[model samples]
Target: MSEATANDFASLDAGQLAALRRRAILSCAIGNFFELFDFTIYGYFAVAITRAFYPSGSMYGTYAAFGAAFLMRPVGAIVLGAYGDRMGRRAALVITIGLMAGATGAVGLIPTYRAIGYWAPILLVLCRLLQGFSTGGEWGGAAAFLVEYAPPGKRGLTGSWQQFSTQIGAVTGSVSAALLASSLSEAAFYAWGWRIPFLCGFLLGPIGYYLRNKVAETPAFERAVETRTVEHAPLRVAMREYGTRMIQAFGLSIIGCIANFIFVVYLVSYAINTMHLPSSAAFSCAVASGLVVVVLTPFVGALTDRVGRRPLILACALLNLVFDYPLFLLAIRGNTFKSLLIALICNAVFQALYTGTIPSILAEMFPTRVRYTALSVSYGFAVVLFGGFAPLISTWLVDVTGNPFAPAFYVMTGGALSAIAIISMKEYRDAPLE
Candidate 1:
């Protein structure tokens, strides 16, 4: 806050710093793009995956296999999160993408259940574990890198690129799935065509790794390194020092994660199943929703820079609370264009108001030393708890209750929890990150 300190911070706002900032966002966003493209594509292809692996007529079994990966996320957070805190964000970013890409390509290589017996699902689970573990570290490091490297006035805009690229990944996955399913014969798709997307994921990993490798360590991290301020045991210090912030992070994260998984990933199944919509229609709807988010997220991020993160976040939660049930009802009203438009509207709201702010809000929570660790743990644990199994849970809720709109209640409940956390936490927009 002092004049000398302000001057020091301003020194990094030079042209070279601007270049670093752009490259940093570009690299981090690409990494996130690949991670999410792989992530969402798995969901998009879950039916084929289950038919190939589970093959028992239980889709939940497939979703459960999908959920199994998430259980490893918290563990990945602790291990790789610490690596990011200590070794540096760029190094951790490269490692996470390498693991993600390998597992993704491995998913394509596994033999079908009929071909390999139970080994098929076993291989699937193993690949999921690797993907989950690596994913645990990717977002935390990317968010830390972007927020730390960002110039003061542009943190929201730069950080928004993280989720902006996430929607790009989602859009790519949905569009790819739609095109593949539409183009391929049913027998061919179930047999081997589903593997193409996973195999394609191999190309992105190397690109993401190359980009992250080219970037410098964030200035905040470099300063910590120079001052010997890096914590040797980052997770321990994070838990001891920022327990409340971590708890708040979980609270804040729950609804956003639910909204994302539900609207983006789960909606594919929800439309195809509960509403009995055509697969192509459902896929097209998902693609439209993703495009909406991709278009709108950056504007929302810029708005947060002006109005601060708290208001938009709270507004997002409140809208979900007030409109979630109605939104679900609208989505199920008919298998028409109107139905898809309703879903797209909900996706737009979730993306612009909530998802856009996640990187900035989360990065601003803890100091630089333990920031990545805290974010990884809190966000990872929250996703494992709710986001990972969201589709499974939504499907189960519908199966058990026989209410087609049962998933709405889950998102609505998340809204209430998020409201409480937002009320409890400090509004830190434009505040010093460390």
Candidate 2:
């Protein structure tokens, strides 16, 4: 056996293994946390970005810019995901975090339309596209890193930290935006305050790079490398061997992606624009709702390890399908902080269950050689089609239909699609990773 495989993880004592797992989790999760924060802050400050970049009379331009990055995700997934399979998970993760940090920081530094005219929005879209590409590579690598390190029968619980860190990043973004908006004068906020969050996102890069550098590459990937099982063309290999599994992964992701974008990212806009809530109230509701996901998701993930993945996934999809419209109605009727909180929390509960389980399921669907490429491409496609533009689509749907509840139907449709997808999926909770 090669040196990489000769240093058997099985030789480590319990404490040594535990320490390694913790380091791996922290290394992977922090980068994902930063990546999510980078994206979440953009969504949180979309309105300010719209005013700053788009001289065009339409907010659609800004939303389109926001969605544009997602268009590059699949390309990134194919390119970077293959890089992970060929180079190593740690190398791909380190590169992704650096790219994300730089792209995110660039957004804060770009001159506004007032100064740069058309160049301002153009630069902003480019930054977003870079962010999208970086994120495309980050998620699958992180998921694979976490699951590959997980002890047998504990993959669900360990993998769930990926989502946990995501919620934490999102909550931090919401709270940061809320605090800045509440504390700064509207003139100051609209002037320069919004860029602060993006600038701070830049600082996350060095930290994530340091953390990832400290952790060893996953044993699974090391074994693949040692055994010469790493694919030279992982994306092509994945498509040829795992086409059906890729579709299953995409279907499994649809509702979670849509619901996350709508309930978590778009809800702030919905509260402010549709319900006419104060920005503070809107952000506060988002923070509370995100906290719900943050706290419950690990528990839900742990539960899946016990009860099975399909049950919770089915429950999440079915509940969202049935109750999304009613929950939207409940918020609209009262139009109060309490009602919005309740509605958002209910929506968040469903999201937590789905997010908690989906990462592990996606990671489990393919063999080590193509795991990164297959899962990332599948997820990137799903997010691009359903999640990435969800806020923009929801905004447009409500605009054209003149019905605030129209976005709820969009979310419900995702739930239905996901339900069908999960119904046909074989349970892989206890299956040994190849």
Candidate 3:
């Protein structure tokens, strides 16, 4: 037989292919869940954490410190992402999981301001940097791992699990924090109740590690190794060959990041600071929104496989631009549980359209040899520019303008940018998984 004919015959049958794809998705999703769980625990417990480390006289200082921690994320992504492309996805996954777990657990044990003075905030920043580093490398490796193993026609469906897992983690963190906070007095909650969620990371880590280790290397990576197709300098190759794609990825990411910050992070702060809602009520609404996102994400992923990334992304962006101001007004004016829940659900469902398919779309833009590095570097930079700084900028904008609608304008601008980016990209639905 000809070499091409032999290669064609080596492909798995339908049943075997289904089984392999399931295993790959589950393995990577489990690890991704814990990584997000650890990272998001901070946001969920931010009020308690800020109270523990920063004085009540300066809420701005407390948030500023949190923003500083977020800034470390891009650096972590670049260093760890390059390592994943150079070495292998499996090794990178293992290291990231370990670092995330260890750093999270250490946060639980760190001394508070009363105990350690200025060192408390310093140590908090150090732990956040470690968490940032682990998360930076985690998404690209995990998403690439799943997509590289997926069937060509269904990579979007398989890769969507990564995005779905993030919302799952958010829900998990929220519920855990709510339960813990409910069980304690306000003094106790501020004193030590916040640490329990971070401690839970230790238990989550081993389960993720076991699942990730059980999955075999992806067929794409195996083939690349066998044929010596691995790039000697994946970063250099990505910058030279795929620079435009990187810019597109960044532009596309703006809406997702802004949506998350506005709906998830700043929403909580707004509820507490502006609307004068109870912390529990605000967090409960967030948990409900997360559940909505989790339910909608997989379906959107399947839809993207059928309709293509451009239409879904563009639709979401345009809808966001139209609806953002109204939604924020509804949320800020009503100040009731029902109104909050309605706004949260709408935001989560719309955001899922972009978030669900992004992993597959970004991964498809590059070949297997440099896919992890390319996606990670682009995503990290976007997060730093759009996601990490979003809450701080929006807060400052609102303060400066003395208008709650200032944040609405910010959201509209991000959505507009994303719409432009999505329309500019080539239709990647028919692209090969490699």
Candidate 4:
């Protein structure tokens, strides 16, 4: 009955709606890619970084330090998510990208432990925290921006591109790091070769900034502001009105966090440490899996649009539970390129189902005023619980069980938890965000 509601209803036509949705998807995806690239580059280059800064330390200690950086992510999410609700999604995104770029560029220039004593690790942790904070803010803003601009009938498809961008960034970071590492001598790679990917983030940052600036504010946000329909305190309102949805989001995110940390981070470590594969080979597998994820992400997104998010997410979770042991067994036992390929393929396919639909589903869970806050808080908390701890937990599990397949069981547990959570969520495809 309101003017904004009337406009939304009128804008649901097929032709012009398609064009706007495309623009939104492209803008959100490109901007998100840069943010994720900066975040993920650390994981891909963690070994080289550890050697440079913690040369005499145990591998577990080095990884523990790395996980410490992940702890800052939820704090960033709470701060920036609230800001996005109060200020604007575009402003939050712009700020986050700038922070990520600055932190990443500084990483390239950080002195080695030999040069700065304890100051080296201190600086590294500081920069990583800043990067975590920036990325924490980036996800919710980007998701809300894309989903709000999506066409009525195709919101899931358009929103999925935001997740797809993460794979694009991961692939880029892995390939670039592999190429740079390979091109340099071992001595050179340890000495100075590892900084290239971090430095590359400088170029990516500005490009993301430019692309994001071109995107208009989402119509949903604009309408809420124009009509003063926004909640007085979005965080409180979300807690009061949408607490159950927040819980659902956290559960739905478990499998994705598990898959990403295991396949992308833990697998890289496992290949290098356990299987004794060359770092190049390990990175190549990661790059290959990322490429597969990027390609399959959109298709999964489209599938969600047709069939709904609940079924797709549950199916992926169930398949992950079934394939968990076999996938890791293949990757570890054979330790061949072929084995890695099969494992990576299975992980990527299952991951795509959840990743592709999450943005739209989360955005649709709340009204425009609180969408960013709700999504960011729930998502960031899940990352802290599931993703932030996954690598460390997987390593600890393996050490305790002395079985290489321990990580597979850990991964399956997460999938089972997610399946239970997602299956209970209320369907909202036809529900309007008022």
Task: Say which candidate scores most in TM-score.
Answer: 2
Which of candidates 1 and 4 reaches a greater TM-score? 1
TM-score of each: 0.95, 0.97, 0.94, 0.94
Residue 253 of candidate 1: its Cα lDDT?
Answer: 83
User: lDDT of model 3 at residue 300?
Assistant: 89
lDDT of 2 by residue, 2-65 (tens): 5545377668899998898899998889888988898779988887888898876466887788
Itemize residue pairs with steric clashes in candidate 3.
Answer: none
Best first by lDDT, ranked: 2, 1, 4, 3
* Candidate 3 lDDT over residue span 1-434, tens digit each: 13342254258798876787688688888889998998888877777777788756445655565566567666766777777776677778888898899989988898988889989888888888788788888878888887887776788888889999977988999888767766778788778788888988877899888887777667777666666778888888989999999889878878887888777887776787678887777888888989888998889889989989878878888888999899988988888877887888888888889777888888888888888888988888777777766777878898899998688888899999988988888988888755
Give the alpha carbon lDDT tens digit for every residue of 1-434 in model 1.
12343245447657756776788889889889998788768899887887888867678978887888898899889999999999888889889999999999999899988999989898998999888999888878888888898777778878888889978988899888888888989788778989998999987789988988887777788777767788989999998989999999989888888887777677677676656676677888888888878888888888889999888988888888888888777777765656756765675666578767888999999999999899999999989888899989988998999997888899899989998999899988978976
The stretch of ten residues in a row with the least summed lDDT in candidate 1 is: 1-10
Clash count in backbone of candidate 1: 0
Give one clash count per candidate, in the order shown. 0, 0, 0, 0
Please tell me which model should have the higher lDDT, number 1 or number 2: 2
Candidate 1 residue pairs that clash: none
As for TM-score, the candidate ahead, 1 or 2, is 2
Full-model lDDT for every candidate: 0.84, 0.89, 0.81, 0.83
Please give the distance, in angstroms, between residue 288's alpha carbon in candidate 4 and its true position after superposition.
1.2
